[model samples]
Target: MPAPQFDPAAPLQFVVNAAAGSNAAASKREIIESVLQAQGRRGELAFCTPADLARVARVSAQKALSTRTAVVAVGGDGTLNTVAQAAHAAGCAMGVVPQGTFNYFARTHGIPADPAQAVRLLLHSVPAPVQVAGINDRLFLVNASLGLYPDLLEDREAYKARFGRSRWVAFVAACTTLLRAQRQWRLRIETGGTVRDVHTLTLFVGNNRLQLQQLGAEPEDTIAGTPGDGSMAALVLRPIGTLSMIGLMLHGAMGRLGEAAGVERFEFDHLVVRPTLPQGRRGVKVAFDGEVTTMRAPLDFRVLAKPLYLLGPQRSTATAEAVSRAEDAGA
Candidate 1:
């Protein structure tokens, strides 16, 4: 089926993550409103706390479908992922206005980081199919992980709360978390009808090729071109000492993680992982697109059967190379 066409007269539903940034929500609101008013386009802004993100996104997405409009996600990858879940489930078109650190999803999809620019672009753009992956029932656009990676995200949030949000602080937080890492996950991984057990510090899945590239976790031709042209990638980090872990961080910082020792990379369409947990524990901490949450064991990770339609500006070859036809009519 083809994507819904862009209807300028229809009201665009914008779900704002109130807890994403330190800046005043009013300032962000003004920026969005100014662009909409200047273009004479109808837009509805719904500001909700992080605690209310899931609920608000669901409501906004249903409203968008009812009104025959696109629901816009305005924040970081976590916000985008949350909104994407609702939009994908409803088969509604979605737009993005990036406002978080890294902005990997937006940048990869060619959505401008500047709120006004992104909104303006979406106002005149049509929707195209974009590949999205899932971990259990939750959607993750950038990446997803378990064990040490999730722990790192929790620590990163704490560091951000105290030192403010920035790439540097996130790095420091990751280092802090790595120095104390000791737990190792023993997982039974099943893929392609083959099962294997392994011990790893973290099992990370990648959907956005840009991120995989940055981390040097390239997966040949399977990592690019969404919808029918690409597959998801996975990375496994073997347990290592603190000093070795520090070296691993340096490799990642320098964009050579794939070449780092004790690191394994592979591509797959679907995977099932069963982790051995402590006695009496039935759930495990998992992080998807920067947000950490507890999920029941026996995680199912796979490329979703249906792609989410994204409305945005056509990007240059550089940014959209990961998904070369992401903005095309046939995408």
Candidate 2:
């Protein structure tokens, strides 16, 4: 497929998620409007709650598709995922305004963290192809996990509710979850036509290179050489004692998980994971991006053949600098 051309004069449709981080402020609307006016761009803003983001995004995307404009997601990765689904379906370009806790997708694409800067960048940026992966038919931009990881996410949400949201609080919650987790999954994994049975604490499938680097699983060369290869990297943590698990957590925190023992990493175009026991049928909890859901046994994961067109700075400058800094900082 040919790359979509970006037009500076094109109209933009902004889909805002009010519950997103930094978006709940009353002044945000004024800031966005001011920026659009300053840029002399035609833009329409629509607000929606988290629950209605997907439907609103689809409506906005359809309008953009008909108008030959771009649809911008003004929230986090989950919001971006929702909007991207519509944009991809309509063959329209997508942009971001990064108002979330992690904003991993936006940061990786070299979109600035500041709302004003992100808006300006998107206004002048071009459409670039980005790879996205899927578990069953649901798409995810970052990574997806099963087992202890999903449980940790649930615990993290509870912690956030009780104590409020902050990086330190999230870290503490993760540590607590790690210390208390006692379960493991005995699973059968099929990839590349080979089946293997193993006991693991968690399984992670990653599509974002920066995330893989942060986890210390993929080397710089591998990532640089195949930035959009339409494949996902798998990191499997074999069952281990609590002490060893703590040690592994420490390694991961320090961005050195690749050197951690009992870690297995591989790349595949498609794979299937199922419980080794016949009686383990009740469906498994899988966490994608920041959302959790239950999928029946024998989960199917694969790379999407088509790429999503995202509006951001070209890889040669912005992305290269961000990646270089992350590498230098050992992140």
Candidate 3:
């Protein structure tokens, strides 16, 4: 939509996931090579299994920095997140080609799933600033959560493995896991110069507006859209009975979660959460951008000041103006 800000002469480096099928990934690589060759450009491809994902990302990121090229991720949101962490640290422009169960990040940023079409768009794209949030030292592109939420992700993964990877399976697994909720964590949460101690089932943070809206969280009303604006939405679910939990799920399904009872939704520039963990437990389970991991107590979540340069569709001037208007109104 805007004038291209890309270097036509520079090569494109892609980090592809071969876990699903080496032959499939290889076919995509061939397509990418053909596209680039037709344009008289060069492109590099690094195929890696799940175990080799991180190492390949780091190497591709370093190559991106040295060569001043874009590091493209050719997989799902989790793979994109891993490559993004490397590209963000190296301060290189990044691109995406979605290939996951849910391509939340790519879809939010308007990146296509078709490899050739996505690469064609990349050639005409610019390195624009995109907002990124951090939990402790790790960056997350879509959403992050702890407590019952991470357990739900784990359960959903198990369901996906046994049944199949589909929206129905994920939704059923999530509803099942959510209905069985019996655990609650006592937490000290600090935000907006205020602190409170409360028991919550989960503390979920949202960065992408689409997912938040789907969950009936209109955080965009208060959270600024401009990059490095340091605004995010958080949802705190307190301990509730089974009936209330079922109603909460229905509200979320109906896109009215923000109005659901026993759920506290608010916007903040930064948040600090201290969870009470058992003795000798090194870290608490946390899930971000569809992947689960463990982090130590006192998980710090915040809007990162430094923006990640993303190569994709341009943000409309009207959208940018609306963000400014919203920020000013809040001020």
RMSD, one per candidate, in order: 4.4, 2.7, 5.3
Candidates 2 and 3: which is better by TM-score? Answer: 2
Candidate 1 vs candidate 3, TM-score winner: 1
Tens digits of per-residue lDDT, candidate 1, 113-147, equal 67888899888887878788889988888888998
TM-score for all models, in order of appearance: 0.91, 0.91, 0.89
Cα error of candidate 1 at position 114, Å: 1.0
Task: Report residue 266 deviation for candidate 3 (angstroms).
Answer: 0.8
Off by over 4 Å in 3: 1-6, 19-21, 220-229, 317-331
Per-residue alpha-carbon lDDT of candidate 2 for residues 20-120, written as tens digits (9 for 90 to 100): 44447456677788898998887888888888898999999988877777899987767888898888877888988987776667768888879999999
Candidate 3 lDDT, 116-207, residue by residue in tens: 88888888787888889999999999889998999999999999999989978998998999999989999899987899998999999888
Using lDDT as the measure, the top candidate is 1
Among all windows of 10 consecutive residues in model 2, the one with the lowest summed lDDT is 219-228
